[model samples]
Target chain A: MSQTHVVPTRVYYTIFAILMFCTYLTVQVAFLDLGALNTVAALAIAVFKAVLVVLFFMHVKYSTRLTWVVVIGGAFWLGILLALTMTDYLSRAWGTFG
Target chain B: MLPDAVEHHHPALAHQFDSLAQQREAAALGMWVFLVTEVLFFGGLFATYAVYRWWYPDAFAAASHELDILLGGTNTAVLITSSLTMALAVHSAQLGRRRLLLLFLIATMALGCVFLGIKGVEYYHKFVEHHVPGPGFEFEAAYARQAQIFFSLYFIMTGLHAVHMIIGIGIMLAMFWMSWRGRITADYYNPIEVSGLYWHFVDIVWIFLFPLLYLIGRHA
Candidate 1:
């Protein structure tokens, strides 16, 4: 018989703390001059925070392999949408900004 | 019939499902599929924002600077806390702790409302500043038109997110009613778990939105 996994409250608290700290870090890092890296830093932090939430808060870590497939598949498709669109726009030479 | 009675069949288990576990798994998988569609829906907007921001980096940065980071940051914290409470709510439901489940759900909804209230305040400030992306909309003469595009994407993206939050709150209300009626249990807490997934997904959207819209221009 298969049993469901129950996460401990302690883990939840720990994740919550980490997320809050990251939130603080992201906001603070925005004040510094990182040039092109500013967007990179912000997006990187955002991605980290999002992964934490997905694994812990969304219970994807404890989920079945099939669930993992669905989650990763979604992200993969989003990547396709963004990547394909950006490649076209970035490679083109436009005369004026809209 | 005798075996079913001896097995103590649960009412929550639908006829098609052989067991409660199967039902739970199916429900979760269904919700994840739904969320995938949502990811793509919002992905389109993010892609559009990227293209425009790439084209008009200066205007995007200048417009992004107009956003109140403090309020946006506070809303991020609030939304994250709500996600925690929501996770806790699911945990409580898993453990069959009815009271804690209800409490956490209420706490989550309250935090959700607070986030919206703060968002409303931010929007009002934008309106007062003539930044709502319409004819009356005003900005620096250099890039006023591009800035309008920024605010246009801002309202649409965040506006759709706000709509999702409102829908999430409505779902929580239904969950609250279900729990209050003693419909949820350790063996049949699919609704709460699915609802939590939706809530967390919403939080994830904001996780990206806060930085993209509010922080991208701070260093500039």
Candidate 2:
């Protein structure tokens, strides 16, 4: 029989607490004046929260290597979509054409 | 009858799979693939939001300020709590704790509804304020047109997310009933596990949305 790993319940509680705290931190930080750092801070916090959720709540941390591949691949593809399109759109302002 | 025909069977295991683990693995992989496509679907909208925000940074920032951050933040916390409940539900399922499973499932669904109810209040506020992005839409004349674009994307993205929440709530209800009947067991809880994945994905989307939409120009 193949063994299934059961995560301890306390771990879920810990992650939940961390997530709630991060939410509060993000909202509080948004009230500060930090110029461009505001956007950077907000997005960075959001990404951090997302990583915690995916790794802990979704059990990708305890999942198989194949599952890791799927998760990373999805994120990689999304990066490609966002980066490639932004490069084109943002560069349009440089006036390359006469 | 052939000897092979007399082989013992596990109720949840399909005949094609060599073992239950393999069946569960296949199901998890299939769900992950579907979730990847979902990421792409929402990724496009995120891209659109980026383009418009870039084009009209001032208007985007100004328009963002008009949004009620308190409400958005509350909804974010609510959704995160629901995800916690969802993860707990999956945990309960894995342990074959029927009562705990049902309790967490109901908690998750109730939280989802609460999030939606708050969203409804926000939308009603928008309607009364004429922020619904149409002919009747109103904003400062200087940024009215650009702000309209902002409101348009806001409605589309959040509306789609709300629709997903509605679907998720329905799924939780069904699972709640199934758990009540004892269809879920320690040996077979793929439905709860996969649904947890879906629920977490939705929560992840909002995790991004709340910051992107509500925190844009708050400091300005």
Candidate 3:
């Protein structure tokens, strides 16, 4: 295990702390009047935070490519599910229907 | 053996697995699957939120403003700390630091309790203001039923996440006791690591939940 695992503990934690602070900044940015860009900004920061969790906290950085595929595959399928469902759900023309 | 001592898989494998590598793979894979399900589960709520936001944008925004940003932000920080401790707990197990393992487990559990306690306080605030949405739930006339829908989803989504937190605390408590008995170690720490996975996934869920429930479109 020692021979194979190369990243030091401090590096992992430093990145974790950095990602957390970025998340905090994203949260604080919500208080400002960003108008139409508010959701976009929060979600962009969220994706960054999710990447940090996946890479470091969950050891994806140290995991095999196969493992990364498994993890990413889950995320991909989730996106598909969300996309298909929301297309139908959101596109319902309210007053157009009799 | 206690009832909880159901099976360890094999004597050569700590009665929990056919082999160390297999046990590790199974535990990690199982957690991934569970997390996928959770994604779908919470995805439903997120979809509902988006749909409702489209329909009742003002009401949803108004109700979101009612959420105490202090509690939400503090809870986010608290949960991130707990995740840090949880990752550290797994690291201690990997390094075979038995005492440190217990310490981190206790620390993680304590942080989890703080999260639930804060959430309980938030729920109490909601209750005092009649934010709990249902048949008798009160809503200002401007909202009609839309604001109530927002609160209904809020309670259900956050309430379900809170239930996961309580279960997470229980898992950590059990692991703490097991650690006391020398059951968890570098070689046989799959369960510990898996519990950390669950805890971290829960933390990740809240990561998104916080932004969606509290932060999205609130800059009006």
Question: What TM-score quantifies how close candidate 1 is to the native fold?
Answer: 0.97
lDDT (0 to 1) per candidate:
0.93, 0.92, 0.81
TM-score for chain B of all predictions: 0.98, 0.97, 0.89
Select the stronger candidate by lDDT from 2 and 3: 2
Cα shift from native, residue B74, model 1 (Å): 0.4
**Cα shift from native, residue B24, model 2 (Å):** 1.3
Interface RMSD of each: 1.3, 1.0, 2.6
Cand. 2 TM to true fold: 0.96
Per-residue CA lDDT of candidate 2, range B1-85, in tens? 7666446467877789888788888888889999999999999999999999989999999888989988998999899999989
Q: Which candidate number maximizes DockQ?
A: 2
Model 3, B46: alpha-carbon shift in Å?
A: 1.6
True contacts kept of each: 0.83, 0.78, 0.39
Answer with 2 or 3, whichever has the higher DockQ: 2
Residues B82-167 of candidate 3 have per-residue lDDT tens digits of 88888888888887799999999999999999999999999999899888886667767898488898888889888889999999
How well does candidate 2 reproduce the true complex, by DockQ? 0.79
Q: Is the docking of candidate 3 incorrect, acceptable, medium or high quality?
A: acceptable
Interface RMSD of 2: 1.0
